[model samples]
Target: MKHDEFIRRVSERAHVSAEQADTLGRAVLQTLAERITGGEADDLAAQLPPELQEPLRRPRKAPADPFGLDEFLRRVGERAGVDGELALRGTRAVLHTLRDTLPHKEFEDMVSQLPTEYRELLRVDHDEFVQKVARRAHVSVDQAQTLTRAVLQALAERISGGAAQDLAAQLPPELREPLQRPRDAHAEPIGLEEMLSRVGEGAGVDEDLARRAFRAVLLTVRDAVPRKEFEHVLGQLPKEVAKLL
Candidate 1:
């Protein structure tokens, strides 16, 4: 509760708009990102006073179950160290899309091909949902069902209703809060090489924009990559960096 509230508050602060909250989130996400990245956490906390600290603390919790619709989707994300709730929303969206377009047969087929490890996580209901969709799509029962489930989950993540908020609710407050206060966000801490690599790779950026973006990350709550980049590194570059002086 506290952690969630603190994030909400951080988004609300005069100095830290909602978009900037996301910047704070990125900067303080990893331990190495904090220590090695250099004062990333301190920079974020600078905007938030001690008074805001208490609210960002939530209780520790296990990620949601894998069988449940919302929880199951959440669990999938948990594997990636992401909160399940947020993940579910995406799943939900994909499901919504499947219901609207993809035939049941295609949905089932997709699931059958899922890695062996995936079978252990499903429930009868989810299976049934796939089965039904499979029949409608007029394809292999097993294969179509899987596809339907996959399609739904994929779509839900992009819908963006409350993915972050829902995920935050599932996490322990301390773990979540500390994520907000990474010790250093600008230095590109060593351990985060993979994370940074993933981001750059996923974004298809070839160069090392990590540090430049890291500096701007502390300024956005909206996740507007370009805008925030301009705001911190570009907008105030001369004044904030002071190389000229």
Candidate 2:
């Protein structure tokens, strides 16, 4: 969104007057734009008053997550071969579906509507593909699918090129309320390494060559004790391997 739209949105929801919101929005935009367009984040920090600048000087703290919304949408958009606008619409739908806890049909239709270029991205027929995005976003497969479909329907009205506003407007009435008066909460993202650690393999595929050493250590687990029993054994190796097969 442009500076004015951003200010308008924030001011509508906050105690800040329009002028104050505009100032705040400009500060935030300037901060973000500089970061995006090859300026040092430290330079922005330097521009800030001392209190804010102090925090910026320390070693850059790694974000708890690197696969953030901006990056995820960018990659997924590229793979899907849809413009960022449509991909964003799909993503918003995905996120909404997971949040409200919807059903599978919703997600399947949403995924199917995207351009065929996304085939490599999903690596599954439409049904499985929809389910996967839902699962990653932390909701039932059915719930994810349904919301995704709903998102597409909603986006039909507002989306153009991957920006969130038009899609944001189309959000379900229930969701609109929250968007209008956003809750005071942090939107923490899931990390890439954390997910690989959970899957236990495919270290090379999801990421680049530089992470091999980290993945190797992450893959190690000694002894085939019942994973359920690991903590009880104080991590001791069990004498028996329980094999149902």
Top lDDT prediction, candidate number: 2
Give per-model TM-scores.
0.18, 0.19
TM-score of 1: 0.18
lDDT of 2 by residue, 70-126 (tens): 565565455445556655544443223221232333333333333444223322234
How would you encode candidate 1's per-residue C-alpha lDDT over 100-122 as one tens digit per residue?
23233343343333333433332
**Candidate 2: stretches off by over 4 Å:** 1-4, 39-245
